[model samples]
Target: MSEKKKSLKITDAEWEVMRVAWTTKATTSKEVTAALNEKTEWKSTTVKTLLSRLVDKGMLGTKRTGNKFIYFPLVEERSSIEILSQELLTKVCSKKVGKVLESIINDSLLSVDDITRLETLLKEKQKTAVKEVPCNCIPGQCQCHLVS
Candidate 1:
């Protein structure tokens, strides 16, 4: 995959369609719609529209096989997830990132191995982490503790 395709902002609807393409590797619109329809109430046209949007975003590649088009992801799933994670992290205040992560961890169901991995990662980060993370949010966004 090209570096340019490494980061993509897929919409919620497009993400559902991409999940099918990523899992299937290569699939037709009919197959994609069927897979998604098992849990969603989207129409064939809706799925097809999302497919087209993904193709436009360069997230999904296409091949014309007979009359139907076979769609496949141009990027790997893991890389896309990392990029999206970084993108989301950048949107929040630096000081609040830890709390954000903690909330996510609290809400998630992780296996023993997953918890172990997180502990290891935290240890590694502890070595270089600052004593305090300064507020990175705009003045209006964060509640200042300093007295006026």
Candidate 2:
């Protein structure tokens, strides 16, 4: 993650393919399509197209394994996730970030370890927590004094 990351805007379909490659370390198109089929109605060709697009976008790299190409994630999964999360958070008013995180936590199914991790993170963040988060919203998009 210390290495500079590319600003790749991955589509939802491409994310599905990337997850498979990241989980398996490497995969051929057949493996990706097979894994995706369990969760999506996408056909094999659709999965292949997404894989090709990811490769072109440099999110995925491939090596020829005899006659077939095995695809692997070029970027670390944690780095990619952080990039995407930050991108999403930037679209909303800064004041609403806590509410957004709360909503996400409520909706997600967390394991005991995950809950413990969040508690630890929250405790650390509490050290510098502000009394009020200032609204950093675009004008006309939100009701805030920061908005002209």
Each model's lDDT comes to: 0.83, 0.86
Residue range 1-148, candidate 2, lDDT tens digits: 1224446588888898898998999899999888888799788889889988999999999889899999999999999988888877777788899989999999999999999999999999999999999776656887786434
Tell me the spans in candidate 1 whose CA falls farther than 4 Å from its real position. Answer: 1-7, 145-147
Give all candidate RMSDs, comma-separated.
4.2, 3.8
Residues 1-148, candidate 1, lDDT per residue (tens digit)?
1124234677878888878888999998899888988789888898889999889989999999888898999988888778888777767777888998999899999999999999999999999999989776656766754538
79 Cα displacement, candidate 2 (Å): 1.1
lDDT at 147, model 1: 34
Top candidate, metric lDDT:
2
